[model samples]
Target: MPLMSDGDEKVDGFFRLGTSSGRFNMFDRFASLGVKWTGAVNGRPEDEFGLAVVTASTSPDYRRSSAAQRTESVAEITYRAPLSPWLTVQPNLQYVHNPGADPTIRDAWVVGLRFAIGSRLID
Candidate 1:
């Protein structure tokens, strides 16, 4: 996360653009943009089905007031099935990225869920 510039020492965890020694120079600036998409599908034995989709984006001017900027995006999906009248389960997944970073962040994941529980009281 070190900002780079000519004739300047690389400082750790510090970010700056178009500047030297915390001074505005208006010569070292950059911009960024991004987009994402997500989708999912599900079905059941009794003719039940489901679908979903999501999209997100970030602009370079979201935070930085100087000439430098960064952007990111993420997407997700989910599916479900019916095992019985009172019981059901679903799974979820996601993806993320940041195209303006050194590592170009990327990731994926999966999750599970359940529903319908019976409780008994004993005296």
Candidate 2:
């Protein structure tokens, strides 16, 4: 549940324990945690802004196969601004660490943009 929120604004999270590897998977017997926040931005309650962080660990299988890297992490920050009632534009930034549980592979930084449209149906 969202423990932090002011009406429309909310924060939520999750915890997971499982496997990520079997036939060439990255993490085996893996564990992960993630959090997400959804709220308004720039005094635009009708618009949207969000931030999320997620992290994971490599399982013993991965460790046995590759010991150099054992953890993975990613963070995403994004904002959406409304250009019309049904149209909006969003921009995003993301950083990743220990991608694919391979220390030899460099961590990554990414940026992107998205466009969205919403519709309401009446019957």
Candidate 3:
């Protein structure tokens, strides 16, 4: 989805929604949004930042059978460093509220890092 951007796609965002028509799928519905902020960061014009949030609900049948089933949500934040044209490093944080949509399961906070290396395209 092309979104508002600064030349070279510096800032952009997206929205998503999903629903299942099947009776067996556990996910009855879900939605999420993701945003990216790139370039012009803290004097470093190449750094990138991202944020996302997701919410999902258990299927009607599952919720009816499980007393603890309910809607669940997760949010994440990340920062990416461009080491070169072909390499980038990203550190991300994630927080889940009511994992598994089961009230008995405590929420969790997770931290992670990701690396991206790709070949530069030559014209």
Best by lDDT: 3
Tens digits of per-residue lDDT, candidate 1, 3-116, equal 332232222232222322223332223322222111212222232222233322222343344332243333444444555555556565655444332233444443545454
lDDT agreement with native, every candidate: 0.35, 0.71, 0.84
Worst 10 residues of 1 by lDDT: 33-42
Off by over 4 Å in 1: 1-53, 59-61, 65-72, 99-106, 114-123
What C-alpha lDDT, on a 0 to 100 scale, does residue 81 get in candidate 3? 90
Give me candidate 3's TM-score against the actual structure. Answer: 0.83
Please identify which of the two predictions, 2 or 3, would achieve the higher lDDT against the true structure: 3
Clashes of each: 1, 0, 0
After aligning candidate 1 to the native by TM-score, how far in Å is the CA of 95 from where it should be? 2.0
Any residue pairs clashing in model 3, and if so which? Answer: none
Candidate 3 per-residue lDDT, tens place, 23-81, comes to 78767899999988877466667887899999998888887777746688999999999
lDDT of 1: 0.35
Clashing pairs in 1: 18-28
- Under the 3 Å rule for N, CA and C atoms, how many clashes does model 2 have? 0
Positional deviation of residue 31's Cα in model 1 after best superposition, in angstroms: 21
lDDT pick, better of 1 and 3:
3
TM-score for each candidate, following the candidate numbering: 0.35, 0.68, 0.83
Stretches of candidate 3 above 4 Å error?
1-9, 121-123
